[model samples]
Target: MLYFCPASVRVRAASGAALKPIQSINAHPSNCICIKFDPTGKYFATGSADALVSLWDVEELVCVRCFSRLDWPVRTLSFSHDGKMLASASEDHFIDIAEVETGEKLWEVQCDSPTFTVAWHPKRPLLAYACDDKEGKYDNNREAGTVKLFGLPNDS
Candidate 1:
């Protein structure tokens, strides 16, 4: 399992009765806000307030790649069910999808409000995200509790 401590990430074994620390790495300069293990369990991703996303190899305990594109802090991350794609949401009004192996940006979508969370479908290339519209700019005078879904393109 993975532990998201402040400014670092720690890996531990869950086999024995007591958890044993395997390795720890400094993931981000600032606080790590979210973490997601890939569906294959061979890798994990960390999102930080420093506006970066890092992919780490589980066995080697080393960072494989780092993605830095957003100016705002990354609020959440989700791996596709097949572990081929990664989706990241930030405090800004956009969501970014990238190729896991090459760190190539696949696509990005702009929303009306700031997105705070993202989740990929378990079996399909569909993504769901929650937005914060506290100023009532998106909704019709109601509180800004909005969840939206989008289908990823096949060619990416």
Candidate 2:
């Protein structure tokens, strides 16, 4: 396979050879800001500065699909424990929960400011995310940043 960085990061094999990705992403110029690999390591997700989330196949090193509903540069990504879903966070004031296989947005969580980080419960469907107050833009009394959990089971 042709090995080149192409302005985007690449996956390097144990032998130090770069396995080329078959994606011609326009976001390469802007570059990816966050990335997450599924539990099985069969696939991975990349969140780009161009506001696109792309899923890549591990075997072929190809981009299988793209999710582009967010309007701002992506900041973070998380794969559900089971690898059935992905949470992509951005400064657009919302987080998108997408189905990994189809790239369909299953749900969204609105925010008061820029959300910079997100993660999933390793043993549950619970999702947690962190956001800033935009330097106390909405509430000067509030902290500079905060983290909240969503989808917590009542039993927990």
Candidate 3:
């Protein structure tokens, strides 16, 4: 199964060689920029230019909750190894982490430039992130491009 989009997202069943579109959804007010599925595939998420991330239940095929901690267009999204924590990155100077089940923001990690990507360790709670300002697109891109690891625990 896949959830993808431009301004809207489509639910597709990717069981065979051909991609058969199952459904189309105007999932976001603005363009949907990125999407990610949790490790279990029971849940998936959509990040948008609206600066919001929408969580969807794979079974019910509906939005279960939303994360709106970012003020800039959401650039990336990733779920923790256990799929209990979700991290969102954007043009903002901070990357926001949210508790998947409760929709509560866990914390934010401050960075020197716009965050471009985030990946959770498959077996650990560590999160790896990258930042860049390619062509000086943002004013905070003083560090060039760097990737860093953060061992942020779910409890803290």
Candidate 3: which stretches are off by over 4 Å? 7-16, 133-144, 152-156
Q: 31-115, model 1: which lDDT tens digit per residue?
A: 8888899999888998888899999998887889999988898889999999999999887778989999999998887878778
Worst 10 residues of 1 by lDDT: 7-16
lDDT of 1: 0.83
lDDT of 3 by residue, 1-156 (tens): 574758344444454457666666567878888999999888999898889999998877799999988999999999999999999999999889899999998878888778989999999988899988554445454655667788855434
lDDT of 2 at 11: 34
Q: Give per-model TM-scores.
A: 0.87, 0.79, 0.85
| Model 2 weakest 10-residue run by lDDT | 11-20
Q: Between candidates 1 and 2, name the one with more favorable lDDT.
A: 1
- State the lDDT of candidate 2 residue by residue for 1-156, as single tens digits: 323242554433333245444444333456677767899888877777789888888777787999999999889999999999999988888899999988887889888888999999999999989888756555667556777888866512
* Local accuracy by lDDT, each model: 0.83, 0.78, 0.84
Query: What's every prediction's RMSD, in angstroms?
Result: 2.7, 4.5, 3.8
For all candidates, what are the clash counts?
A: 0, 0, 0
In candidate 2, which residue ranges exceed 4 Å CA deviation? 1-27, 134-144, 153-156
Winner by lDDT: 3
Error of 2 at 49 (Å): 1.0
Order of candidate numbers by TM-score, starting with the best: 1, 3, 2
Off by over 4 Å in 1: 7-15, 152-156
